[model samples]
Target: MRIAYLTIDNINDNVILAQTFPLLGRLATLPEVDGIDLFALRKHGGDRYRAYLPPTRIRVRVGNNHGIWHPLTWLHLVRFALQAWARTRAGAVLIGRNPISLLCLSLAASRRGTRLVLDYRGLLSEEYVLQGKIARRGRMHRLLRRLERWAIRRADAILCVSERLRERTVRWQPVAAGKIVVIPCCYDPRVAGRDEATIERLRGELALDPARDFVLAYAGSLSVWNRPEAIREVFHAFRQIHARTRLLLLTGDLEAAQASFGDEAAIIIRSIPHEEIQHHLALADLGLLLRDRSSVNRVASPVKFAEYLACGVPVLVTPGVGDCPDIVRREGVGYLLDADLPLSRIVSEIRANRSDFRARCREVATRYFDGDAYRALYGELVGGKAFRRLPESPSVGKACA
Candidate 1:
């Protein structure tokens, strides 16, 4: 079976390298897949990330000239859809990585008896309101919802990043629920190898003592929903009890992170190359994933959750981030902060129970966020066969196979 996957993202965004490429690489390995055509409708104008594309088994066509608000953006979408539709063979699968992409291809999907798959990552409309891009339930929000609904209704299969997201989508479009499958944002634990020299060097640069200082790390962007202020609050609270505690902010927005935590000498912020993130995360004992409780976050799956666990760094995440809180609680991999748990106590518990955390967190990563299972699911989705869910995961289980 052949496949076409489309997404609208800035070429420079890390998701293209970390998320998209990895996913396509896995799908290309499936025996049932003949080849894949990736359509990247970049929202900006650059080819800085083009060099990172995977091997030729997955052909990439990047459309990198139109901004989201540009008058020609819709026309560009139509033209791109036509190009994708023309390239597809009969019975080929067309997968949209977002709502707008699928909405554009809905008509084309029905033409050649091809399967349409919606890769639902999050609630885009609610996210726009959270980011102040559009008002809640306003004109633009309603329009986006209609488009999403249209796409979801027409999809032959739907892939959700979290169970909560699947549930919410079911409530929104009850008839489409049966086609949706939950597949969280996953990672290959092999990417997070221990490098003692790199860890020591990062410690030296950050002025953190290997024996005395405990590092709390927050990786990824400082998006509005991520609540950088909440991270700062947690860091300060930890420092109040343990003065040697240090905060490391590894983000792409270096200037914004510096502006937020510049006055604190105990805090270190830097924008480093993506390849070096594993070593930097290795330096930390705990990972911070704080986000405000909103509809946007309620059904979201942040890849950092899996990244932290894969690195053997237990998370200190807030409640209501997809299925993360439940996973954290059930798996004993991290602490979920609330009005009940004191900051000092949680830190003390973490420091005392540092041993064996690496093993346990790695186990959780394999059980819940393993990439192999997702690859199996994607294989089945694109293979034009009846969907058969795999058994729940055990140790290296085939939950989606």
Candidate 2:
């Protein structure tokens, strides 16, 4: 079957490269897939990500960026939907990687017999309300919620990032239960690991004291959803007990990081390129996946959680951030930290079993987060029959259970 995927995210966004592109690449390689047409909107740095696209069996189109929430954006998506419909044979799969894409693409998809897939990430309208972007009872919020429901109802399949999210989706729209497939935000195992040389190099470059300093790393944006203030509070509390510890913030928004943490001169905050993130992550002894206990985070799976584990770094994650706390406890890979909890005990535990944690974290990451592990799952979602035969890198990782 031919497939056409549309994402409203900037083609250059880390989400596109880390999650969407990998899924697309996996789909393109499936024997059941004839070819894939990927539709995206270009902004600055879009060409850089374009270079990473699969060179065979996939064609890409990065259209002009008219800006999000603008009227032109909807028109652009409508055009993308119509284009995908016109180009593909009947019964081709049309996937919308976000709510906006799904809503617009569904319009064109309904007119055709193509299957529609919703790449449901989280509670979109609720997220906006939490971020203060929209009032909870406002017309825009209600409209967005309605459109989200409509899109969900129209989807032939729905890809959820967490089991909790799938549950929530089902509760919100009972019809979604049968169509939903839980696929967590995964990481590429190839570049994610602990390399001795990389650790040494980054240690020297960042002036990190290997003998004295215990490193705690946080990677991602300082966006409202990330709760940058909560990150700071956690790091500060950890730092109070472990005076020699360093908090490393590897973020894309350097300016925002500076604004949030610049006053602390001892903090190491850098905006490293996406390709170099794993190397920087290798320098850390512990990764921080702090999040508020909100509805949005409860059903969300942050990619950073997988990334930290993939780099052989155990996390100090918040208790209710998606399925992370359960995984951490089940695998003995990390600690579940609460805001009110004291850090001395957690610190001692980590110090005592750092090596064991590192090894176990890598093992858990291979089992859960590796993209290779999810190939068969992706095949199931896309209705591709070659999943069992899909190429596996025996040296790299194992298939998902």
Candidate 3:
């Protein structure tokens, strides 16, 4: 069977999608599955255009440029729906984060008797409110919430990145409880398994003195939800405990973050290519994920946590948000800080348990965050069975062979 995957974001730049691509590549090895076609609607000037095939080898089609605003985006949605409806004979329509695209894809797939799986990566409306871009009780927020509810209700299945998000979505759309599935963002073992030499080389290149200074690293978007202030707190605590401890931040918003905290840290590397992330991870002694306690963050499942574990780097995370604390606790991989805990206490704990912490990190990645398990989960979701027997080959068409 053929499936049409839809997205509105810059699919090329999204790390979650890139990580999942290998799983999709593996799924293509299934004997019973035909193929997975990606349909993306992108912006171009004031008008939208379509491309039948993507520029790269990735299985995707780019539709004509759609205007970024309301009515034009809706028109592009209708056009994309028509195209997807006409192209795929029977299977599933996998909808990504776009609410407008989900609505149109739902309608198209319903007409063509195709199943719909909605990938609600995050609560967009709630995210907007948490970012202070929109007021939670305002007219626009209420309207978007209504649309989100409608889309959730319409989906045949809902794929959430975290259990917390699944719970929240079910609470909002109680009817979707049985339909919801949790598939957290995971680290691809291929990316996670860099050689020791490569890692050491990266350490040298970054000028990271592992013997002299303890490294604290944070990688990903430098957004408000990530709580830059928490980094400051951690650094302050580190200074009190160990004068040589250094903080390193690698993020997309380098200019803004630099403006905020560049002068404070001993070393701050701005955003690097996603490919270079593992190198930084390898150089780090500790990983930090300290999010603000916003409603959006409460359901966040950050990919960085898994990456840290995969690289055998211990993490220091905040509790009461998403599954990070639970996973860390269950796997014995890292420490979880209560928001009310004094920064000094946190620093003391880290300093006291450094050796055990690193060991826990290795154990957790080996046990729970195994890439084989992640591949099997994706296979089950898409092919209705595990992919344990699948071979590692680059044949894109063999996924559903």
Candidate 4:
């Protein structure tokens, strides 16, 4: 049997590291996975994450540069169909994401003995609408919903990024309840475990006076949905309590983000490699994740949430941030942001339970968002529990040979 992962995301995209790459790696780790192929409509050639991969197969369609409006977009779909049709055979499972990929891949995966598995990584239409990219009931909006319904009906198994997302998906397609599984934005435990020396060096490089200041870190896209003004508000709140508070902004477009907070004692970092995120995160006393409580947010799972925890840094997030709210309160590893006064409570509590929260946050990361969880979930998807607890091990799950 062969398993294929199809996506429209560029192969080198930072998100692909945490999403597509880790998934394919987990499947490749499985002994039962005979052949694993990753099919991406890539931005460029060669895989940047090849070193991190667990020897998975790769097949990509390059030169895709446009969105739905472009004529080349449809051509990309036609090319994918031809390529997928050529490789069509018995006992194949195509795990797909993105509306274009899932909609088009479903057509080719219709061949006998091929399975279609939809991984709804995000609530696409809802998100786009919230971002003001589409009208509430526009032509594009309806088309996206139609595609989502089409995939839900055809998917043999469905993977959701969060439990709330899975529930919402079930609400839309009631009959899909049985086939759904929640697979969150996962983190590699290894990335968060930097030695003391590495952390110290990173601190020096960033000129972080961690001994005095409370370093707060926020990485990834600085999207409008993040409520950029609220992020500034949180920082000012922290600065009020702690005089030496500094915010670390790690994003691809640091210039735009830095302009929002001019001349503050902030370190604006752009294009930092995915692996190096841990080093910067290590210097922080707390991680910050605050987004609008839009309907699209209810099903959202932010990779930063898991990565922060894995690095043993507590997160300060607003309520309704996917599973973080539940985990933060339940585990006492983080706090919920109060818009009226965002950082006061977390800052005070953090002073007393700094050591305790560190351990608990890492624990939560392993229990919930660890990459190992996905390994088991994928294992279960393929057959009888491909991921299992080893008799001799204390960890939650281990890859089966």
Model 1 is weakest, by summed lDDT over 10 consecutive residues, at: 392-401
**Pairs of residues at least 3 apart in sequence or in different chains that clash in candidate 2:** none
lDDT of 2 by residue, 1-401 (tens): 88888988788888888788788888888878899888998767848886666556878877767766677776777788788767866668889877878865765576556788888898888888987878998998999889888888988888788867877788888987667767688885445644778778778988988567788899998877787888888778778898988889999898888888876866898887777888888888889887778889999889999899988888888877888888888888878886566688777777787778878988888877777667666777778222232233221122211
lDDT of 2 at 23: 81
TM-score of each: 0.94, 0.91, 0.82, 0.90
Tens-digit lDDT string for candidate 3 (1-401): 66667776544443534454544555555555577777665543222222212233346666554444467766666777787777756555455454656776765566555667676777777877876768888987898788888888887666677768877887777897766656666665554666778778877766777656778898877776788778878877777777777787888777878777868648666677666677677677779998877778788777788778777678889876687888777666667876565656655565577667766776666555454554555555554332232333211101221
Q: CA lDDT, every prediction?
A: 0.79, 0.78, 0.66, 0.73
Candidate 3 backbone clash number? 19
Could you tell me which 10 consecutive residues in candidate 3 have the lowest summed lDDT?
392-401
**Candidate 2 lDDT for residue 269:** 85
lDDT per residue for candidate 1 within 207-234, as digits (tens), equals 7875788889998999888888899888
| Model 2 spans with C-alpha error above 4 angstroms | 111-113, 384-401
Q: Report the lDDT tens digits of candidate 4 across residue range 1-401.
A: 67777777676777787666777777777776677666665565455656656556554455474765568866876777777777777777777886667776776687898878887777778877887778989998998889888788877777777767777778888988777667677886456668889888878877777457787888887776677688788787778888878888878766777677676646445558778878778777888889878777878888888899998899888888776787777787777776465466667677677778788888888777777656656766655332333442222222222
Cα error of candidate 4 at position 383, Å? 4.0
RMSD of 1: 2.4
All candidates in order of lDDT, best leading: 1, 2, 4, 3
